[model samples]
Target: MTAIPSAELHTPDELLANASAMYASGDPKLFRGAILESITALEAFVQRTVFRSLEGRLDPLLVKWLEEKTRMDFDSRLSVLTQVATGLPINKSSELWDGYKKAKEIRNKVVHSGRKVTAMDVELVMASVRDWLSYLGTTVELEAVLLTLKRWVEQSPKPPIENEAQAIQLVAQYFHQSAAARITIEAEINTGGRRHRADMILDFGPRKVLVETKFPRLANNVRNVIRDAVEQADAKRQAANIGQACVIAFLRKRPEGVSDVVERHKGGGILSIAIETH
Candidate 1:
């Protein structure tokens, strides 16, 4: 896990962070914080991606007019941003307009009519904004790191890796200097059996992620490695009092039913990402 520094958090990230904090407090009224923040996050994403990209495309006078005369209201901004993004080659079209419309409508009701939004309202808004934000190149820091890792794995050589150590090294090559500083290799912890060694441990201040690497050639071999890695990750996580962990399986062939396993463990704070080399 890569820790995102507070300084590097974009507007959407910061809003989501606040929303998460409020949600975790178990106060129902505070759910509004999540809704409001989600709206702001969507607006900020539009400014960052759509508005910023138009820096040189529009006439200077027109740009200045927009800056000075535009309503800066949520709906107005969203409309302009969507229009511009849809027309620009640099921007990707989104399928999130329906969700965006719903979110904005709910925001209007809540703010204009003093309405109370349920947990579902907040969840819906967040889910909708997430896609738009992602398309606009805005995401939480950890998500950004994970995306980079996925891209690295996809771009890596197709030949199977030699061993666990080589696979670990390959993953490490993608880490930034700051991330590299927080990594611990072969970290030892007491787990009833003298010393239980974790292949890698990433310390992200509040979140610790245990990573296990494996190179599997056969179907049975993949299962065995996954079992061992999950056990190792669990032991390390329990010892460290951390809840997040993942197993990276560098595979010659993806085993049948492995995707189901990955989906099952997703909500349980464990991830199984199979990186195919063949």
Candidate 2:
């Protein structure tokens, strides 16, 4: 497969520049054209970056369906596909998303029906698109999260978390105190029709993840405990658009036994971390 030439990839900035130029020309007739360029910018970002990111992350068939067969609107790409492939959670109800959705509607009215858009309409689309792009730098990166956790667990004194609850609280506090990013953690998030509570729900700006904690002191099958936590997290994750993770804190010490369960699920997007006792 021939790679897409880098020069051919249109960034949001470049397209926005063109859109802004049109918007500033003082022509209502060109307002729709400007909005059209903005929509193209969104598509370019998704097609160029998102599809490539999913090469090995998702199954080939699903990836094909998502990229080719599915006629995903902007909302679907932002709210669903991007999250599935990249773990970048997007809350559709956020003010940024709400604004982009309005911009999309305005663009649709202009493009799909050939209707005239006002000066305010063009400004709304430009502002909304820029707002969504501003968070790209801060979106959740799974490796970064795991790296942060690794550092937290390896601290000199170690986190003195005794049970699952303490682990959750301490983990939440750790994220809150983090200098790089102050993640918002909510406790006992009800997912799957509120049938169960996810131990800790973290908001990483444009991303969200539900965490399940396990503190097994005497359990013989530690692998099974971790696997069960992964399954629980996966279920909760599937119920919503958020990502999932399992944080297992050892009350005694880290179990040195596991048959690739940790490695396998980490690849599956349910990050399982063990806080070893030092």
> 1-278 in candidate 2: lDDT tens per residue?
12111112122355478898888898877888888887787667666556544544567687778887546565677777766655655787788778988988898788689777888888888888876654432222333344345444655454455676776765665555433343445445456457667766655454465667677776466767877878877877777667445554454565567431123264446666555645
**Candidate 1 overall lDDT versus native:** 0.60
TM-scores vs. true structure, each candidate: 0.49, 0.46
Write the residue-wise lDDT of candidate 1 on 1-278 in tens digits: 23322212233344467766776677888887878888787676565444433442466577666755654565555566445533412222445767888888888898999888788888888877775654443212333344345444556554546677788876655442443226788777787767777777776543566777788767767777787777778777788776667777877667776642232153445665576654
For candidate 1, what's the RMSD? 13.0
| Model 1: residues with Cα > 4 Å off, grouped in runs | 1-151, 155-160, 177-181, 260-267
Worst 10-residue lDDT window for candidate 2 reads 1-10
Tell me, by TM-score, which candidate is best: 1
lDDT of 2: 0.61
List of clashing residue pairs for candidate 1 = none
